[model samples]
Target: MTTILVTGGTGTLGRLVTERLREGGHEVRVLSRKAEPYAVDLREGGPALDRAVEGVEAVVHCASTPRGGDERAARNLIGAARRAGVPHLVYISIVGVDRVPLGYYKAKHAVERLVEGSGLGWTVLRATQFHELVQQMLSTFARSPVMVLPAGVADQPIEVAEVADRLAGLAVRPPAGRVPDMGGPEVRTFPDLARAYLRATGRRRAVVSVPLAGKTYRAFRSGGHLAPEQAVGKGTFEEYLRR
Candidate 1:
C-alpha cells in the first residue's frame, strides 16, 4: 500500500480525500495546524511537516489560508516534497485562478506555476467552488432580513467528495499535468443561490442584487470560474440544499 500525505487533511475536502484513500487500503497521513489524534501539522516546514513527507508516495495539497498566503505554504511544501523525493504531488486549485483578479486567486495561480517548475511529477486539478463553501457564503448573507448578492456572478458549486474522489484517482495514477477542470452539474446565478437558500430554510427575505464593481466582480461575471462543459460532479445545488 502506498503512503499518502494530505495537507489540510482536516478541512472539508481534504478530510474526504484522506478517508477515501484509507478506504482504498492506502496508508494516509493528515496534515493541518489543528491536527490531532491521527494527523500532524506542517508548522511552516518544521520537523513534523518534513518528517510527514518522508516515505510518503504522494501528497495531495488541499491546504490553503483564508488571508492569502498560499504561495508561501506551497513553496515550503514543494521544498519538503523535493527533499523527500515524493514521486507525485497532486494539487487542488480553483477553476479560474489564472483569470480571476482576486488576491487569493493570484496566489493559487503562483502555486500552480511553482509545482510545474518544481521538477517533481505533479498533477493539478482545478475545480469549481465546493458546495459547502458556497452554502457558507450564502448563509452569511441570509443572516439579515435582506440578502445582498452580486448582481451578475454565477457559480457551479461542485461536491467536495467528488473532487476528493478524483484527487484520490490522481494519486494512484501517473501524474497528468493540468487535468480537465471539474465543475458542478448545474450553474446558478448568485441571486438564484441566495433565493434557494432562503427557500430551503423556509425564510422570507427580500433578495437584493447589488452590482459590484472592479476587476474581481468583472471576472466573476465573465464566467472565469466556471467549467460548464466539464460538469464532473454528481451533486447539484438543489440537492445540496436539501441535505
Candidate 2:
C-alpha cells in the first residue's frame, strides 16, 4: 500500500478524502496543527513540513485558509512537495476561480498556478460549491426572516463526498492537469436555494433577490462556476436537505 499525506484532513472534504484513501488500502497520514502523526501547518513553515512530505507517494492538498493566508499556505505546500520529490499533487479548487472577482477565488487561482508550474506532477479538480456550504450560507442569512440573495446567479452545489471521492480517484491515478470540472445534478439560483431551505425546515422566510453588479456578479450570472455538461454528482439539494 502506498503512503499518502492529506493536508486539512480534519476538515469536511479533507476528512472524507482521507477516509476514502484509507479504505482503498493506502496508509493515510493526516496533516493538522494538533499532535497527530503528521501534524503540519502550511502557514507555519518549518522542519515539520519537510518531514510531513517525505516518503509520501502523493499529497492531497485540501488545506486552505480563505479567511486569509491561502496563497502563502499553498506556496509552502508546493515548495515542500517539490523538495520531497513527491510524484503527484492533487488540488481541490473552486469552479470559476479565475472568472470570479472574489478575493478568495483570486487566491485559489494563484494556488492553481503554483501547483501547475511547481514542476511536480499535479492535477487540479475545480468543483462547484458544496451543498453544505451553500446551505450554511443561506441559513445564516435567513435569520432575519428575509433571505437576501443575489439575482441571476446560477449555482450547481455538489455533494462534498462526491468531490472527495473524485479526489480519491485522482490520488491513485497519474496526474492529469486540470481534469474535467464537476458540479451538482441541478443548476439553481440563489433564491431557489433559500426557498428550498425554508420549505425543508418548515421555516417561514421571504427570499429577496437583489441585482448585483460588477465583474463578480457578471461572472456568476454567466454561469462561469457551472459544469452542467459534467455534472457527475447524483445528489440534489433537496435530497441533501432531507438528510
Candidate 3:
C-alpha cells in the first residue's frame, strides 16, 4: 500500500481524510505543528517538512492559512514535495475563488497557480463553502430574535465530510488535474439558512436581509461563490443542523 501524507491533519477536513486513508489500508501520516505522527509546518519549509514527505507516494495538502499567506505556504509545500519526490500532489480549494475578489480567494488562486507550475502530478478540487462555516456564520450573526444577512444572494453549501470523502478519493488515484467542482444539494439564501438554523435549534428568530456595500457584497449578490449545477453533496443544511 502507498504511504500518504496529509497536511493539517488535525483540522475539520484533514482529520476525515486521514481516517479514510487509514481505513483503506494505506500508511497514513499526519503533518502538524505539534508532535504527532510527524511535525511539519508548511509555512516554514525545512527538514521537518522534508521528513514528513519522505517515502510517501502521495501528499494531500490541506494546510492553508488566511488569504494573505496561503500562496507562500503552497509554494513551500510544493518545494518540499519536489525534494521528497512525492509522485502525486492533491490540493483542496474553494469554489469560485477566481470569481470572487476576496483576499482569501486571491490566495487560493495563487496556490492553484503554484501547483500547476510545479511540474508535478497534481490535482485540484474546488469545493463550495462548508456547512460548519455556514453554521458558524449563523451563530455569530444571529442577534436574539433576528438574523441579519446580505441582501440578494444564494449559496449552495456542502458538508465538510462529503468534501473529505472526495479528497480521499483523489489521494488514491493518479493526479487528474482539476476535478469537477463539488457543492451541496440545495440552494438557500443567507437569511433562509439563518431561519432554518434557528428553527432546527428550537429558537424563534426573524431573518433580516441587510444590503451590504463593497466587493464582498457584490461577490455574494452576484452569486460568484456558488456552484449551482455542479453540486454533488448529499447533505442539506437542515440535515447538518439536525446533526
Candidate 4:
C-alpha cells in the first residue's frame, strides 16, 4: 500500500480525510502540532516535517488557520515535500477565494498559487464553506440577543465529511490540477440559514440583516462565495442541523 501524509490530521476535515485514507488500506501519516511521532508545526518546517513527508506517495494539506500564517505553512510544506521527493500534493481551498476580498480568502488564493507552481504533481480543490463553520458562526451570533447577519449574502455550506471523501479519492488518483469546484446542495441566504439554526437548536433570537459595508461584504452580498452551478454536495444545512 502507498504511504500518504495528511497535515492537520486532527482537525475536522483532516481527521476525516485520514480515516478515509486508512480505510482505503493506505499507510497514513498524521502531521500536526501535537500529534505523536510527528508533532510538526507546518509553519516552522524542520526535520520532523521532512520525516513526515519522506517516502510518502502523496500529501493532503488540510492544515490552515484563518487567523493567519497559512502562507508560511504552505511554503514550508512545499519545501519539505520537494526535498523529500514527494510526488503529489493536494490542497483544500475555499470557493471564491480569488473573487472575495477577505484576508483569509486572499491567503487561501496565495496558497493555491504556491501549490500550482511547487514543481511537484499537485491538485487543488476549492469548496464552499462547511456546515460546521456556518453553525459555529450562527452560534456566536446567537449569543447576542439579536443575531446580526449580512444582508443579501448567500452561502452554500457543504458537508465536511463529503469534502474529506473527495480528498481521499483524489489522493489515490493521479494529480489533476484544480478539479471541479464542490458546493452544497442548496444556496440559502444568511438570514435563512440563521433561522434554520435557531429552529434546530430551539433558540429564540431575532435574526437581523444589516447592509455591511466594504468590498468583502459587497463581494459576499453579490454571491461571490457561492457555487450554485456546482452544487454537487448532497448534504443540506437543514439535514446537517438535524444530525
lDDT of 1 by residue, 1-243 (tens): 999999999888898999999999999988888786335444356667678899999999999876866877888899989999999999999999989889888888999999999999999999999998899999999898899889888999998889999999999889999999999988889888888888898998899998989999999999999999998789988898898
What are the clashing pairs of model 2?
none
Q: Candidate 1, TM-score vs. the true structure?
A: 0.96
Pick the lDDT winner: 4
Counted clashes in each candidate structure:
0, 0, 0, 0
Residue-wise C-alpha lDDT for candidate 4, range 1-243, written one tens digit per residue:
989999999999999999999999999999999999999988888899988899999999999998899999999999999998999999999999999999999999999999999999999999999999999999999999999888888999999999999999999999999999999999998899999999999999998898978999999988899999999999999999999
Off by over 4 Å in 1: 36-43
Better model by lDDT: candidate 1 vs candidate 3? 1
Weakest ten-residue segment in model 1 by summed lDDT: 36-45
How far off is residue 227 in model 4, in Å? 0.7
User: So what's the TM-score on candidate 4?
Assistant: 0.99
lDDT of 3 by residue, 1-243 (tens): 989999889999999999999989989899877846587667777887888888999999998877366787788888888988889999999988998898888889989999988988999999999999898888887755667778898889898999998999999999999989998998898877887888898777778787889987798789888988887899999999988
Reference-based TM-score of each model: 0.96, 0.97, 0.96, 0.99
Q: Please list the residue runs of candidate 4 whose C-alpha ends up more than 4 Å from where it truly belongs after superposition.
A: none
Return the number of clashes found in candidate 2.
0
In model 3, residue pairs whose N, Cα or C atoms come closer than 3 Å (at least 3 residues apart or on different chains), thus clashing, are none
| Candidate 4 local distance difference test against the native | 0.95
* TM-score: model 3 vs. ground truth: 0.96
